[model samples]
Target: MLIQKVRFERSPKLHAMMTEAPYPVNARVVVQGKRGPEVATVRDEAEPMPGDGRYGMILGAASEADLDRWAELGREAEDLKWLLRARARARGLPVKIVAAEFTLDGSLLTVSYSAEERIELGALIQDLRGHTRARINFAAVGPREQAMMLGTLGACGRENCSSHHLQDFAPVSIRMARDQQLPLNPEKLSGPCGRLLCCLQFEHTQYLDLLKDVPRKNARVCHDSSGACGKVVKLHPLEGTVDVLTDAGMMQGVPASELRVLKGEPAPGQQKNRPRD
Candidate 1:
């Protein structure tokens, strides 16, 4: 598969694997760095990097040794975390060191953290470089990336999607919101990344399937009276009910059996509910 390096230019340098050869969902990558490397597998395929293409590097088909290096570095992730934290405090940088992971090849050491502003972390980088003898990178991860680094069980009682199965992060739109009829609350809609949840894409096909057979909301239908027409009110896909507004001057609740959909006309042929002349 086409592998990618997960380096946070504005954050840290963590190498990850793009699982698929050409890169598809949950594309796994082994992040390589000094102090050890990590395998930050992609839960989605790597897309073309936007803009100047300065996001991260890519490595093709790593070896077994590469994976071992990641495991070794993971062992000291906690210790390096402590060092970075102490260093940040002494340097008077208001930062929260979330987590740290080493690269698989020992070529780089990435420190993951979060902060309010872009704190000058040059000193911290220098310190880590000198101490670890590897390329030092300070990664400022957000809620989403943080969730990827420090994984935990999900609401479904399984590992978080980013940490386990999702390869690349896709753009979650308000369409998913409208489709689910969910409240337009950012907090409620967002996942660990502080963006729309990945699960929103799940079962989307099924929803589309249900909608396929249903008539359009604006569709017009005919009432029992051959001369009367009606406007579609609401649709019940599963129940096959098409509640309609009768064009007749008067209307009464009627079962769908008493109604026939109007065809071949923009407006209703018969007016069931209308004003008296």
Candidate 2:
């Protein structure tokens, strides 16, 4: 029989699952992991996954005995997190324990936490070893990762996108905001992660394309029918309107289609850091 590949349903950072076989969704099964067999649900239909000898397999749907054992492990892991958190707090460690998970066989407890910066944990790990016979694994994550592991609400008045569905973060910069004519205020543009908002990347491409047909701010323009000239003061892209400072000393908003560029060289106040269209 041909062996097929499958991935267990769960966040890769929080729970590791991969390997071979075809299985139906919601089928509880145990796969031989590095430490021991662990319980995981058949997340979805199986698909092929290329591997270099680091894959685990689905032994089969979990038995009643296996389910009982998994429940016991969950309670134990919760207790472990509490203990570790108390100890770290007592030592004045700058860390927030997000979660703790036990290896299927109970040989190890993987503790996840977030820290502002790196700090020595050698002494703490050693102390944990002496306290618990089982080995402990420490995983450090950033603020966004912490929220994803734990969960958080965003300024958008909803559950954070990262925690709920944003699996991968893309690079965002001030340029994205500039391209969209958004206020460059950091507080308004940043997300709960203290980084640029993830949504900034969404409409950037549309803004870039819209800018091609728009004239830059302070560019000289004239009404084709009346031959009255003016310098562009502002542009409302979605409205298809342009505010112009007419040579007659009046500022008026007019349809973009009625205006033609008076100069072909360049517009004043056009900079990579400041583009108004």
> Lowest summed-lDDT stretch of 10 residues in model 2?
1-10
Compared with the true structure, what per-residue lDDT tens digits does model 2 show for residues 1-277?
A: 1133333322423233564457676667787766566777655566556445455566777889888987887787788788878888988998888888776677887778888778777767876776567788888877767666666677878877777666577788888887777778999998887888888897888776666666777788898887889888877766767788899999888887777876573432333344563
Off by over 4 Å in 1: 1-72, 89-96, 104-107, 114-117, 140-142, 215-277
TM-score of each: 0.55, 0.76
Superposition error at 225 for model 2 (Å)? 4.8
lDDT per residue as tens, model 1, 90-134: 888999898766556556666778987877887887767656776
lDDT of 1: 0.58
List per-prediction Cα lDDT, in the order shown: 0.58, 0.71
In angstroms, give how far residue 147 of model 1 lies from its true place: 1.9
Clash counts for all predictions = 50, 1
| Cα lDDT for residue 109, candidate 2 | 79
